[model samples]
Target: MALDGLDHMELEESKGGSGLRQYYLSKIEELQLTVNEKSQNLRRLQAQRNELNAKVRLLREELQLLQEQGSYVGEVVRAMDKKKVLVKVTPNCRVALRNDSYTLHKILPNKVDPLVSLMMVEKVPDSTYEMIGGLDKQIKEIKEVIELPVKHPELFEALGIAQPKVEWST
Candidate 1:
């Protein structure tokens, strides 16, 4: 009876050992699967991070290019604006215009006397005057009108011709 009891106890011990081994192996397999899944997730996140970084770099380059273009355009506009001419009749009375703006400058007695006295008269180019087609009659009329102002200042005042306004570029 004692020997039989001892044999049964040994059998029970072997069964328990087998069960524990199976449980431990199954737990280890589950842990390995979890570890592999986490590693895959980490790799995917790293790839996404790299793509985002590349996009940010591209955007920064584009922004820098735009800023440079903006500054260049600003410089061009400033140069264009600086090409204007400022005409001052008196110290307080001033008018500004671009060189290409007006067809002619109507000379008054006061203005002509100063220019003639200073010998600063500039002859108008025939090509410039001829560019205004159908203005022959107008030019003749303007010459006739200006003759009185040049010859007689009192007559011009009586005729009441105002100071001409300055023109700007198109």
Candidate 2:
């Protein structure tokens, strides 16, 4: 009876050992799956970080382009040779131009300034000064000043004086 009881105890211990092994294996597998899921999430986040870095680099390049400073326009007065030109950029100064800097186009009337472009905008085929009105007094003044000097020269001669000259400028 004592030997039988010892054998029965051995059998119970063996079954308990198998249960503990199964529990350890299930726990280990759960931990391994958790690690795999965290690794996948980390990889996804790293890829998103790389994509955002690329967008930032593109925006930086665009900002640099928008911050550029200077280019000015000037006229070429004369072509000196193939490599240079005389450019008149200021009232009293003349600067040389590069070979590829200037181009020549047909003259277009400058209509940006109304005072400068009054009657000089373009040449009409049939234009007349008759369109101007309300200048009778001004026209008579001009005619008297001009024709009096030519027609009545003796008046000035008799008075021993020269006719007064007038000049008009726009």
Candidate 3:
């Protein structure tokens, strides 16, 4: 019997040959070695990832601490800039006034009385007075009231009073 197409087929196993078994065992060993090398590479990559995560966590904690410290320092600077003003009318009497962040203090002798006065002024144009023509009498009265302190400072001082100072400009 002549087998033309199946001439090259191996019949080692059917013939109980040890050569075929040895070839299969060698292939298995090669595959196991390849698997071990791949597993070691995967472990190295995982360790690198874990180290990066720890560094990120440390940086976040430092940033939070710095922000808290900045707020505390700001509050301390504001407290230091606060102002308190003190005024003394006599040896037994004193007065104080505070502006935004400044303090003013005044002291007077036993025979002299200290008088302090605070005034607020709003600036308006002279044309505004002409526009409100019907308020001529009212405007005059207001002007007199505003000038009373300048015209009679001695009288105000005799009454133990301090007049509000005024400044007018264009």
Candidate 4:
């Protein structure tokens, strides 16, 4: 009877030991899975950070070139999320239209306004322009309708066209 009880105790001990070992093995697997997931997450974030850094570097180079050109490129009226900027563009700026007044434009990477992108992105050094069919006619019309009014206001006045009252207050 004593030998039998001792045998039973050994069996129970073996069972408990095996159960503990299995539990530890499962725990180790869980921890390894968590580590792998964290590593993947880190890699994804690093990739995004690298992309954003590249974009920032490109933007810096563009700003430097604009500064060298001595053109009124525009001012960052507001910066939002490092991705978008509210730019106050002067009338002479390419992004600005006919009016001799400053205008606010929101410039973004992917969601840039069509007109703004046409005026801004076309100035890229690597871009090429295919001449449109009616571009010369459009230019002539623009010169007569917009440039003439601003450059020679007397011509509009002589044609009895009422001009907006411009305040030259400095």
lDDT (Cα, tens digit) per residue for candidate 1, span 1-170: 45574576566568776755666688999999999999999999999999999999999999997765211000111122444433443422223222444312332232235657678647745565568898899887876665545655676577787533333233
* lDDT of candidate 2 over 1-170, digit per residue (tens): 45574576567568876755666688999999999999999999999999999999999999997775433344556779985566665422323333354443223333256776686847645633366588878767876777676668788789797876655432
* TM-score per candidate, chains pooled: 0.34, 0.40, 0.34, 0.35
How many residue-pair clashes does candidate 1 contain? 0
> Which candidate number maximizes TM-score?
2
Candidate 2's C-alpha runs over 4 A off are: 1-16, 78-170
CA error at residue 1 for candidate 1, angstroms: 29
RMSD of each: 22.1, 18.4, 19.9, 19.3
Model 4 pairs in collision:
none
Worst ten-residue run, lDDT, model 4?
Answer: 91-100
Which ranges in model 1 have alpha carbons more than 4 Å from their true place?
Answer: 1-16, 69-170
Per-residue lDDT over 140-164 for candidate 3, one digit per residue giving the tens place of the 0 to 100 score = 8976677667777787899888788
What is the number of backbone collisions in each predicted candidate, taken in the order shown? 0, 0, 11, 0
Model 4 TM-score is 0.35
What C-alpha root-mean-square deviation, in Å, does candidate 3 show against the real structure?
19.9
Alpha-carbon local distance difference test for all models: 0.57, 0.65, 0.57, 0.64
Please give the lDDT score at residue 138 for candidate 3.
91
